[model samples]
Target: MKRSAQPLVAAAVLAVGVAGVFAILAMRPTPEERPQVKRAPLVEVMSVEPGPYEFVVRAHGTVVPRREGDLVPQVSGSVQWVSPALASGGFFGEGEPLLRIDPADAEVAVESARASVARAQSEAQRARRELSRQRTLAQRSVASQTNLDDALNAERVAAASLREAEARRVQAERDLSRTEIKAPYAGRVRSADIDVGEFVARGTSVAKIYAVDFAEVRLPIPDSDLGFLDLPLGGGPGGGEADGPRVLLRAQFGGEEQMWEGRVVRTEGEIDPRSRMVHVVAEVEDPYGRQLASAGSGSSTPLAAGLFVEADIYGRRVERASELPRIAVRDDATVFVVNEDNVVRERPIEILRTQSDRVIVGGGLRAGERVAVGLSEVVVDGMTVRPLAVDPQSRAPMDANQ
Candidate 1:
């Protein structure tokens, strides 16, 4: 009886356990049948603000002088005096004496010329008096015709001699003036060779110098960049003065970076055959003038010669255009514009120009429209997106929490 009772209890426990498991399964909630929901991608967007935008083209070049030449002496002589400002890297004023050759020979030549002129004048006067007296005598039948002819010839010869002496005198004066070499313009000396007591020949290059009134920079830009610049195609003033497009030059100077203002002065006469680059000349007036000092909170710096600088040239102004990040535009010249409902669709845009970092759009988009940025090629039309507003300059999300 005990063995039968044990089997019966075991069977009862197994049945109870199975019933409990079934009861718990019945109490569980049933799986609900529903349609799948597509997940929308998160995208960064920028608001298009179409307005007048002056394009900026970047280029780099070395600063140079608008006018540079070798300082040569027109008259040969021993250098009796040398200007301190005639040395290499020296500054000088316009018409300032750079060197003084020994003027002893020049002075002697002038004296000799003056003496010749005086003698010629005396002879000419005496011959004129003699010719007049001979004319009177011939009219009175007192002098022979041969004698009157001789007097006339003497007067003419004296007059010619006087003219010759006067020419010599003028030449002597010119040679004297050239003995002292003066600066053609206010400039800095690039190099010098002669010194005091050194004999220099005529037309010898004693030094090399350049004008500092206007510093020039030859900026080489691609031929494609020509359309954006209002350069002087005729090599005239179209690229200069206040009317020309402005330029901002940046460079490291005095152990710190500095900025300078200039303008496009002109373009080179011909394109570079090998590079197809068109070099544009930029001019800055009074680079070393007083305007550089205390001009703008100790920030106005002079554009020195030979300084390697980066140029940001202001180009053509577009009446209505928007600058978008380069990644925003697709290869097909289309952009993804996100609507108010967060639906993105491909829209064609008229691209004016493409730069390394951005694209200048001329048309095909309205102001205040959100343009998707940094989207992948896998983007499809009518795709849903979670839009995030971003800064125009930095492209960072405007919301701090983002």
Candidate 2:
């Protein structure tokens, strides 16, 4: 009976303690709930303006002469006198005497031929007089018909001999003229192998020369780049500079940069089978002529042959095109366009041309449209952002921040 009473007393104490704890928790105030706040990303944006855009195609080539070949002599003889203009790097005018061979032999030959012609004329006159005398005698019954016939034949033979001698005289005169070698055109001498008293054979090359009136550069451009240029299908419209496109050629000269203006004169009829490139011939008029004096341009330097050059060919103009920074465009021709509220979305644009640092957008864009030039790489579409307007040229943030 004593053990059962103790157990009942312990259970009553434990129930009282539990009731006291619940009453204390019920008296505490309820905690207040709070909300979380998120900020949008900051992005650099630029306003795109659409207008006419001119495209340029670049290529490289080496300068070359329009006409170049070996200078060969027509007649063979020892070079008695060599002109100063016949040496290497020398300039000469059209028909200028380059050298003179020993004309003593040629002059003697001419004189001898002339003397022979004079003797033949004397013999021919004598034959004619004898033939007339024979005819008179035959009519008077003094000379027989056989003698008349003989005189007539002799006269004919003498006339033929006179003609032969005249031909020899003409030939000798022509040979005498050939002894003095003259330049065929106004040109510069590339090299010379003959000098005073040097024996050269007929049709032998003695020097090299090239015309200096103009220079031609064979510029090979990829077949795909043809669309940018306005070229005729068959070939460039003739060899003159009257038509086709203009090319600005640049090169290093006199330890400085230089520029020359040229025109597309023609293109090769057949494409290069190996490279699949079309070779267009550009002509620069008066390459050795005077140039405008300017600083840092080496303007006085002539566009000499064999100099490697870079060309910038002016192409057609595209209307309603926008120019954008290269980074703003992706390889798949898409860009991020920001809206008025700074929300971003991807937009596809037609890329007319691509350069090292810029891209020409031909269509699918309008004026006053904002393009996000700088943004997070992993930013997704329809994401909101803090827009910062920036200058396109300097790339510095402008005063406006949307």
Per-prediction TM-score, please? 0.85, 0.77
Separate clash counts for every candidate: 0, 0
Candidate with best lDDT: 1
Write the residue-wise lDDT of candidate 1 on 1-402 in tens digits: 888799889999999999999999999999999999876777888999899988788999999988999999988889999999988889898999999999999999999999999999999999999999999999999999999999999999999999999999999999999999999998999999999989999988989999988998899989898899877777856533666668899999999988889988777899999999988888888887634443664434667788999999998888999999998999999999988888888999999999888999999999999998855335678987778888979988885212
**Consecutive 10-residue window with the lowest summed lDDT within model 1:** 290-299
Q: Clashes in model 2: which pairs? A: none
- Candidate 1's C-alpha runs over 4 A off are 1-37, 238-240, 290-300, 400-402
**lDDT (10s digit) by residue, model 2, range 212-307:** 778988888888888888765577575446677889999988889999999888888988899999988888976876333323445446889889
RMSD of 1: 5.1
- Top candidate on TM-score is 1
Off by over 4 Å in 2: 1-37, 119-164, 236-239, 290-299, 355-357, 389-402
- In model 2, the Cα lDDT at residue 216 comes to 89
Q: After superposition, how far is residue 268 of candidate 1 from its true place, in Å?
A: 2.2
In order, what is each prediction's RMSD in angstroms? 5.1, 8.1
